[model samples]
Target: MRDLPVLTGDAVADAATDWPIAEHRVLGRGRLNTFVSDTVVTPDGATMVRDYLTHTGAVGVIALDEQERVVVVRQYRHPVGFKLIEPPAGLLDADGESWLTAAQRELAEEARLRADDWRTLVDYMTSPGCLQESIRVFLARGLADAPRPEGFVLEGEEADMEVCLVPLDDLVAAVFAGRVQNPTLVVGVLAAHAALRSGREADLRAPDAPWDARGAKAARDQELGELEAP
Candidate 1:
């Protein structure tokens, strides 16, 4: 693995010190929505940058089954003014729970699948240039059926999601065809693919076919190892 670049405390402090907020305003706030505008003096001091953004908490999953099919959702997106095909996802609404907990809830709500295997893939800014929300993507496996929660319904909202299963290669091809454009979906799918490949390699390296009582545990361990590290 390539070593990541280190950032010193002094460097971060210098950068923070250079940022001066001259003015700020609360643009608006509605159900699960908050908007704000801020004026910041740039490092060069030639111009002031005014930033406006909306903030929300988001969660998504790359759900895979023993058959290797990935669960996806088809929903209408108003922002893009079109229908979008993507993974099971939703906004975080529960208080006091960690982000991963919210991800598990969404996975159960959207796809009705509870994954015995869970791993956080990445935390990323969805649109740093305009939005203040950060999205957490997770990989889920060893799925079992669950009853859909009552409060987790998204019907009558601006979205109507239909759950579907897609083969891995077909989904990747759709991504390249511009059919799957959601950012979180792309990242989560790729991460799951890499994890699956790693699990296969580990199995090949094992000395024996761990098919007895030890076999199931060995297989689960391989999956967990690939998950936790990424």
Candidate 2:
């Protein structure tokens, strides 16, 4: 049997430290144009270089229809080169857009539906080792047909995207069977199924749940205005 470690600790506990970014450089930029490389000094004073993507964050919605079916969309992801089945999701690029608002917009744009009840299922960082993208998943229920947000035209893969209403359990089975492979969809379906089976709706967070690590460091850096001499 393979050895595994079971970690048990107080999640609410954290250690405080003022880490320093000794140096920074812009390697290049792409469609998400921004400076995204860095050199920093560890607390122990060791120098290290790192590169990461900068994002404004994102949201995914697990939209449930009247029959308790989940909304699934099949779209092509260029980088991964896969036509993955996924839930409605989008980047939080709109100025001053709150997380819940972004989730609502993405749901409306991709699924063309709105919900009567919304709860935050989970918030996580995608590929934290090399990406600075923070994502939140929301559980949306009481869905009904609606028009897409104004001027939100679908183009490219999104224009030709295929959407289907899938039974929640069937979607969960597809996730486990390697048929549905999008990160957001897998996480969401498994979570939603477990929550529904366990009757743990009371444990769900409100739509406005605080995301502490959602670019708080960048905001803090902007406030501190250079913590140490260059």
Candidate 3:
């Protein structure tokens, strides 16, 4: 049997630790801001500067059709300079939105899809080494084609986006073959495939579940800002 996590208050505190930020500075600002320097001090007097991006987190949806196929969108990422296929995902920090609401909006906007059933599939950090971004994947079934939100226009690369419906088995093959490598897409597809293969629904977290790290990190950053105020 797998070891269960400790759910005590102290254990929870330890699990959601907010590292002491000795100093913090913003290097640049944009839609997603950058924290160019953050001095972290440990209890043992060790200190280090961590340069990482600050994100509001995001959500991805794996919309499944009645035929057991999943929808994917193709768009170009300028930073990577490669066209990538991924599930419909949107930022959580947008306008102080909830995770479920963001996922639902992204589903409609990206894939022109609506679903009757939804469940949490997996939650992941895209790049832990240098990014503070986390994305929660949701499995959405009972899908039907729908019109995009009124007066909401797709812009830039999204304006030319392409959508495709691929069988879950084939998608798993592509994921294993590295043909479809978007983290959210790969994780969501493989997880949904595994769950369906086992003929059982995976135990899922509540859609509005609280994410400790996102808020805890922000609070830590806020405390540092307060200390720096003069």
Candidate 4:
């Protein structure tokens, strides 16, 4: 048998690459997201038009209390027609706000809570094939109750959202049983579980860890927008 290469932790990194864009156009613009189409040239000399949504990115917080309970919110997702159990999360719509600030703000606004300890749990691209939405999930401990953000009022689906705490072990089981399908919650639960089991929670990335993919995505979006402009 051929000798296999030794496994190294460094081999799993994701690299950034882009194809040449021949054309770009906005198909539609909604309140929070934009639908666009791009004509990209493949390396094999074929050109294809791809339609996708341009998002503002987002952050989610897995707030764990002293008893290993995770604070979560049940909110209705109109497009999916299901009320998903998700961690406190929100978009990066506020200009110039850092991702950690966004995560902290969301935890308060959506769950009426705050945390003194914070670490990055994971960062992922949601539907990278068609959507440009990047999400950062944070593990927040040292929990305490806090008032909602000033001038923040829940509306529509958020108005009916319910906040509750569930044991982390239960959440992990739900994830494996296919009971919870929200991407953020699934990834956050599994990552947090592994971190705790491996005793590496403290060694996770800092709350303000550098996120180059998000910055690169924003820059590419700007260039595409400029190209689509008259």
Candidate 5:
């Protein structure tokens, strides 16, 4: 085999591409998400129908306290049938809410904590193949106890959620040992670990950083009139 090409600086990044949708329709609508089918025309002129969920996106918070412990919550996920250990997270379904505001709200609601310092840890698509769910995870420090958001009554799984602080190192270990499988937690833990270890925590993105993926999705949603269609 020839010598592997040496990769250099930050040329590797996700770019958005819009595929031509010949037809689109809503297959179903859930309480918080929409199931849609799209007939896409490929560049080669072949058409394929794909079904996926159009989500309202979400935000996660990795609340790291002074002792380097990370706030986590164990909540039951019905679809996966597991009480997953995850960073506090919630959907961005509220009208006119910013992602940073949503993250702060979820942290307060799920963990009953707030942070004076917030930075973007990472952003990811839960499952791009079949879900348009994008999650922005924030690294939160300078923690303090806070009351739950008013009228945010916990029900079902939320009512049973258990919140605790786990050491960042322990969470990282659990992630590698396959003990924790929640994607947001795993990514946030690892990202926080990497940043702290490399002393690059200060270089992390601002809490209000621009999210191109979300903007692109919103534009596409508008173009398709997905939210307005009855």
Candidate 6:
């Protein structure tokens, strides 16, 4: 295997400023820095580079129930132009909560269901070229209905959302028929399949789900062992 190239710089040099919608302060810088700016592109395909902030990876969950139904939410995505089907997910706001904790919180807030079992599906980079956005996906099962958490409203920015439970077969058919098209959801479904085939669904947990450095290594080891054994 070839080693990846690493760049080291003491300070960030602001290159030539292109036309931006609005100028904003830089959020961070180092390996990757972030800035906030209004960047817009015309319909004619003209490109406009603007100031934008870079962020780390986010988390998402594909919560399933005992009946083989997958919990999904229909939310209006500004960039997508309409409501899209997606699993329960959200940004991690609390400083110390683990990714699995965020997944549990999102599931409860979006679907009002708390899963008893969870197995990580995979870690994915949503966009790597211009933006630094990674998403961690999980497979949650053994769900039960519960009360929505306090202050768990998708107000203002996320007001137009409808949550539902969908059958797994329906989801698979949609994928094969070219209906479900989100990359994160696709990865989650494929991971769920591998978990089902190997009967490894019992391993993922809220306190110990593989989302970080050591947990990720352990999960990968378990998966590799399963593949290598008879």
Per-residue C-alpha lDDT of model 5 across residues 45-157, encoded as one tens digit per residue: 99999999988889999999989999999999999999999999999989999899999999889988889999999999999989988899999999988999999999999
| Candidate 6 Cα RMSD (Å) | 14.2
Compared with the true structure, all predictions reach lDDT values of: 0.67, 0.82, 0.82, 0.93, 0.91, 0.67
What TM-score does prediction 4 earn? 0.95
Model 1 agreement with the true structure over 110-190: per-residue lDDT tens digits: 778788867666556677666656677777778899888766556653246788898877877877787788888887776
lDDT for predicted candidate 2 compared with the true structure? 0.82
State every prediction's TM-score relative to the real structure: 0.73, 0.88, 0.87, 0.95, 0.94, 0.65
Local error of candidate 6 at residue 80 (angstroms): 2.2
Task: Evaluate residue 22 in candidate 4 and report its C-alpha lDDT on the 0 to 100 scale.
Answer: 92
Model 5 superposed RMSD (Cα): 1.8
RMSD of 3: 4.0
lDDT of candidate 4 at residue 63, scale 0 to 100: 94
Candidate 6 Cα misplacement greater than 4 A, ranges: 1-33, 36-53, 198-230
Report the C-alpha displacement of residue 212, candidate 3, in angstroms: 2.5
Model 4 alpha-carbon miss at residue 100, Å: 0.7
Which of 1 and 5 is the better model by TM-score? Answer: 5
For candidate 1, the per-residue lDDT at 175 reads: 74
For candidate 4, lDDT tens digit of each residue in 1-230?
A: 99987767988677788888898888999998889999999999899999999888999999999999999999999889999999999999899999999999999999999999999999999999899999999999999989999999999999999999999999999998999999999999999999999999878999889987787797788788789788
lDDT of 3 by residue, 72-119 (tens): 999998888889988888887667677888898899999888888888
Clashes of each: 1, 0, 0, 0, 0, 4
Give per-residue lDDT, candidate 6, residue 198.
75
Residue 52 Cα positional deviation in candidate 4, in Å, after optimal superposition? 0.6
Model 6, backbone clash pairs (residues 3+ apart or across chains), number: 4
Candidate 5: deviation at residue 82, Å?
A: 0.4
Question: Residue 229 CA error for candidate 3 (Å)?
Answer: 5.0
Residue 103 of model 6 has an lDDT of: 82
Segments in model 3 whose C-alpha atoms lie over 4 Å from true places: 1-14, 200-202, 224-230
| TM-score of candidate 5 relative to the true fold | 0.94
Model 6 pairs whose backbones collide: 34-53, 34-54, 35-52, 35-53
